[model samples]
Target: MKKYLHTGILIVILLLSGFLLWRHSVQTRVSHEVVRVADVGAIAWVPFQVGLEKGFFADEGLSISIVSVQTGDESLKALLSNSVDISLAGIIPYSFVALDHPEIQVLALNTFAKDNQIIARKDSGVSRPEDLIGKKIGYSKTTASDIGVEFFLKNHGITKGQVTLIPMKPFAMPVALATGEIDAYSSWEPNIINGKKLLDTRAILFNDVLSTYTWHGSLMANKTYIESHHSSVLAFLRAWKKSAQFTKDNPTEAIAIASAYTKIPAEALKQIWSRYDFVANPSPEEVVSILRTDLLWANLHRANPLATIPDPVTLLANINESKI
Candidate 1:
């Protein structure tokens, strides 16, 4: 009789263990089975991080998993390779896509004309686009910065032959310019701010140089992923919009959050943050303008401007003002 009771107890224990394992499996599946996202480590993605930290994505019944990429170009590669579900890089890749593919649709434009200026050495005798010729021009990746420099120089009548373009990262731009390793590197802040102290020249209106330029650091998803999870895409966007509103409402706290992501000091970020005003659905005209320039610039740079550019109207989202 005692042996019979022992066997019965062992069977009950096994059944209970099975029940607990089932519950744990269900919870784990529910926790992360939504959307997978990726972001380049830049200030452009501050709002997305803020939303995740504040439970904004969770509130939308969505789960966004992010992986850090070294640069926007790498992020695009990840999205294309299916390594990441989505990309938070700018529309620069869209330009190459437009010429051929634009598989990644630009869902929303978060910011534009954010202190993306070109500075010069105090005594470099370089003040305008005209002054850039015969000088070594520094640009990184032949990516977004190269596009900016191309337009800035062309509008000033400086051709490719007039200047030398060297590839350098954004942070490295300040040192390259200050050390005079290159005559003028297309500088973007916080490098621009640092460049001001290192190099000695005043900026010559790099912002809106192509007034039609739309440097949108937008949300993008692959066609396959979006097809399978349409609701997930909408939910992520809803969460992102809420974070944008939070940024507008709490400008100070927003800076602290952005400061954490960028690793620039909070005090320094406060000064930089004031220059940019982030938003969603930056007009269609803005998208067209930037695409036109990026494509033409890429053509000149020997990069393949094919396999991604799709129709702008189909890609951009027109959110209702009243809906938000």
Candidate 2:
């Protein structure tokens, strides 16, 4: 009887150990998990690019395919259309979409702040914000540049009406300013960087100097996808966090990755690289601040006055910060 009892106990223990091992294996086997990431091709997204080059995504049991869009809004549009799993774009643009699509979930705030400057040609004789009055100023409508210009003008008591606002493509702004088509242009990097190199221009004002949203690049996902692919989401964030850390620790390699990916010259990327703050996860308060600022910006620029402002709680409801 004693021998039979001991044999049964040993069998039970072995069975339990075998079950635990199987569970571990199954949890790690996140195969065929593909993440379609649509993002702007900028130095701010270097961490993700570095992750792809270093196999960080695969290490987390995910396969990621990146689609580089011309602008952040385009990337967000792709997300809204269900053409991509994740969208990496500016907070203000995200806010515009989120007001209508409350189903959007934010994963992480990847970058904070940029040097959106008002670049004026030296010969234009526009030395300060006040000089912009009655002069044609070029900017991409409703973008960071527009927001930056608005706040800068507000600081100097110059309204948009005071300036002959020329709506121009960002790439066209530098040339327009140089060739006397427009006296000045409000643009962000690498265009601004390129403009400086191609023309004798001076930056009169940067976004940081103004009372604007500043700008943050965030990673977002559709709510349905987040709900169903919880593990996958966590895995992606883990990989992203790793990449961000790697970038900080290895600036030279990070610069190279960003230059190659963005097609911005290495020197240009380096000059403005420090302007970007790459954070893998944002605090709840930070997320709320960004959302609130976006709402205010949209009210001013997007003509979305009737849009409901999202509170901090509602904004952070879907943010998964467990790993960070």
Candidate 3:
């Protein structure tokens, strides 16, 4: 009887040990949450790239796959079509569709900068703001660059009738100016940077008008995604916060990461890095104010004449600060 009792006790201990080991293994393993993000490969998105390269997202148990697009408008489109879980884009793009799709939310404002400029050809006699009066100004319509150009002309007392506004893709603006397809173009970096390089001594940049406006680069998601994946959204925001601090603390390393991700030269990124404010979250009031102004402009210029302008307050409600 004593021998039988000892054998039984030993068997029970062995089973318990196996169970404990299995439980430990399960507890220790991480199930990564996959997040698909659409981005317009801009320098403003450096923090996101930094977060990816530095393993910050991994720390949050997130596996991020980036979908590159050419413009913020395209980024928003990807999100709307459900092709991407999140989108990194500008305030202008979000504002354009905010009324139609009230479900889309701005998760955070990652970048705020006055980075747009009007690149003109000196040979075309655009030496100053007034010189742009009769010149053909190339700009990407329905984008932030459009607003920049409009504000620029307004600031310089140049009427739309005085100058011909030509619609062109942002990437093509520099080459168009170089080839004399347009006398001047309004765009942001690295297009602005490239235009100067292409024109060399002939390129002149006007930034004073753009400096009055601060452009916002934001992270956005749909209401359904936010509701279903609240924890994931919070995790992303936390990682972004860390990334922003890291970028500010380590400028050289951040520049290298951005340069690699954007394919822009490191020196050029470093030159404009100081201008970008990589804040993970901005005050809701400030965002609302900026959006209100932009919405007014869109109503007057971009929106359909019959479409009712959505109240900026309604748009402000979509700013998800709970995660921030």
Give the best candidate by lDDT: 3
State the lDDT of candidate 1 residue by residue for 1-324, as single tens digits: 999999999999999999999999777656755677777656667788789778888887777777876556677778878888878776665455445545566666676535445666645667655777788877756456666676677677778887888887777777877677876766455555567665544433344544113356777776667677766677777788899888878878887887777667788777667565566554578766665656665555555545443455666544333433
**Candidate 2 TM-score, true structure as reference:** 0.82
TM-score of 1: 0.74
**lDDT (0 to 1) per candidate:** 0.67, 0.75, 0.81
Which pairs clash in model 3?
A: none
Q: Please, what are the lDDT tens digits per residue for candidate 2 over residues 1-324?
A: 999999999999999999999998777765648899996765667888999998899888898887877566778889988899998877767777777777886777778756667777657677666777888988766567667677667887998889988887777877787788988777666667667767743534334555333567788888888888888888898999989889888888999988888667787687777787876457678677777877676765555475456664565436456654
- Angstrom error of the Cα, residue 196, model 3: value is 1.8
TM-scores of the candidates in the order shown: 0.74, 0.82, 0.86
| Model 3 stretches with alpha carbons more than 4 Å out | 1-30, 209-212, 303-308, 311-324
Evaluated with TM-score, which candidate comes out highest?
3
2 against 3, candidate with superior lDDT: 3
